[model samples]
Target: MGRTSDAGEKILAAGRSLFEARGYSALGVAEICKAAGVPKGSFYYFYASKEALALAVVDEHWADQRREWTRILSGVGKDGGDAGGAQPLDRLRKLFEETEAGQHAVQQGCGTVLGCLFGNLSLEMSNQTEAVRARLQEIFDAQVEMVAAVIGEARERGDVTVNDSREAARSVVAQLEGQVMFAKLYNNTGRLSPLWGNCLALLGARAA
Candidate 1:
């Protein structure tokens, strides 16, 4: 990476943290610039506007999360297959466990950016910034699709008995997102544990 690339990454890193910790609407370009230790002028050199930078931050955050999920999914098997073929439902539960563990490790509730960012921006920019809303929706849709894939795989492997894997996946994703929102709102990270258990039970029953 060149100097320009390095600078861009620094800006993105700062933006990601701020966006995750606060939100897109709460944090300003100047705040991000200051956090990055870069001049305001340099912000425009890398991004057209705050919205543009936000899109980049969202993309970067999504990429990192996808990798994390992939790791957990891949870690469940001796051969390193999707959760090691450990009953797709159980694998999914373990995935949530890992997610919760990550949040606990940071001593922060819900380390994921998607749910919080979307919830915040949807309320603030849905009517104004079509671009931002569209990008957020795209990321969310992809996440739901990934969940659906896992559920579909579980059904195929007889680990789940879903009549509609896609719908089931979407439900799981929705439940997880809602739990995260609730956890953040109340600052009670423990609230997610029961949700996780319930989801696992649903998956198990469906599989049976």
Candidate 2:
């Protein structure tokens, strides 16, 4: 039973890695099972189908990413203390920096820039599966809401001149995904460097 449970986690890890590397439509359950070192039966035991596994993978990835985003955008330290009272704009900049650093690290390890998983899956699967499409929409909506909350804080502090924080946040998220797509296309994480400047322009942020 213990080994059976471990196989489920292994399948999820392998599925996520393969999905990120190759996109969802290109992989098969047999391949995932082989990479996971688990029997094909184990996959059926844990997931109803590849789509189910994909949904699970998407949820798991978003959970991790949302946690990191929450931490960075909230200005909380890694050790659970205040991050030196970082202002909202500063926290937003740090989010971009951290994203760039993460992409760079992945490039260092894999010699290829795997862009945002959600963005990639959205492009590939959003049209093919309603389940994935709806899930992706929800994830993106949540992301926009999170950014809007930060933008609201910045507006309150007179740091930005945006009237509609949620709309501005949607643009910010779109800009981020577009830049990440360009980064992946050019195989250069440096493409992410302009995100902060673009975000500031979008927000009409006050001069520091």
Candidate 3:
């Protein structure tokens, strides 16, 4: 395959920012072009259509998010070493703390609670397009897998009592997205704590 063009990366980056700032329906092909500083022809050269680009953005954004997830939840320390030596519950707390910190940054920078990208797209386009909806479901499933892996590690160490790590992971992701949606509606990050608290209780991941 040919090397990825610089224009492709720029367009995807711009699309992510704009699509996150506004929903899919609100942004058009022309607007994406302008933000990306690329011509109409250039966009089609990389992506077949706006919808196609949206899928690519989801893939790209999730790749970046997953790396962070691995770093925090997987217990990889700054020097790329295993700090998984920490209790699963402790690692879970640190991961959620990091997630909260990131949301706080987005809230400050965007001047509003911009909820999870996957959640936003899931709500907006899940019923609109089968392919997009399928892609999103896959992303959510991958999220569950990631969380479940962490939970399994914790479980093996006797830190988490849950026998069904997959189910528990699903609940955690659902609650997270639900809290994010609430934050968006209330325009406050304060709602996250109680929701998170409930998850900690349910998963028995609370600190002593």
Candidate 4:
């Protein structure tokens, strides 16, 4: 990448890290600029305001998470074949296990829990700005849709006993977000394990 592009990316990376480690309202543009190793003036060149930079970070984070969710739920698209033949429940389990492991890795590397970016941003920005809140809601709605897709598959295949796929999907989202909140609170990835059974039971899915 060119120098200009590199500078923008640096600011974004630093912003994501800092904002994730600290709440959005708790950090400042000068701090982000310092973290990115860019001049404060250069920060303005890339982002018109700190809120703009925060939203950009949100977009980047969502892109990465959306890709992972698609892979986990739908499998990679290739010649009309799934990457794995695991059923919906199995896929859900894989998502849980992988999320735990990924968060653990983040904790080790960054010394922070770095839980759900959407959850973090929503709690901090929900009443702060309609634009950011709406974007966050859009991102979260996509996640709900992805989870709903899995539950729908489970229903069609008779893999689960849930009657309301939408409600069940919301329960799954709430449970996972709560788990992430606790994990972030305690800085322990293992906090996610006990809920594995709770989620499976909530969905009425077969055991892993």
Error of 2 at 75 (Å): 0.4
| Model 1 root mean square deviation, Cα atoms | 3.8
1-208: candidate 2 lDDT, tens digit per residue: 3453589899999999999999998999999999999989879999999999999999999999999999999998668888764899988988898899999999999999999999999999999999999999999999999999999999999999989999999999999999999999999999999999999999999973
Candidate ranking under lDDT, highest first, comes to 2, 4, 3, 1
Backbone clash total for model 2 is 0
TM-score of candidate 4 on Cα atoms, chains taken together = 0.90
Model 4 Cα lDDT, one tens digit per residue, 62-102: 99988887787765433446757467777777678778988
Cα displacement (angstroms), candidate 2, residue 25, comes to 0.6
Q: How many Å off is the CA of 116 in candidate 4? A: 1.6
The 0-to-1 C-alpha lDDT of every candidate, in the order given, reads 0.72, 0.94, 0.82, 0.85
Worst 10 residues of 3 by lDDT: 199-208
RMSD for all candidates, in order, please. Answer: 3.8, 2.3, 3.2, 2.9
Clashing pairs in 3: none
Cα deviation of 151 in candidate 3 (Å)?
A: 1.9
> How many backbone clashes does every candidate have?
5, 0, 0, 0
lDDT of 1 by residue, 26-83 (tens): 8888889899888988899999999898888777777877777766555544345555
Q: How far does residue 110 in candidate 3 sit from its true spot (Å)? A: 2.1
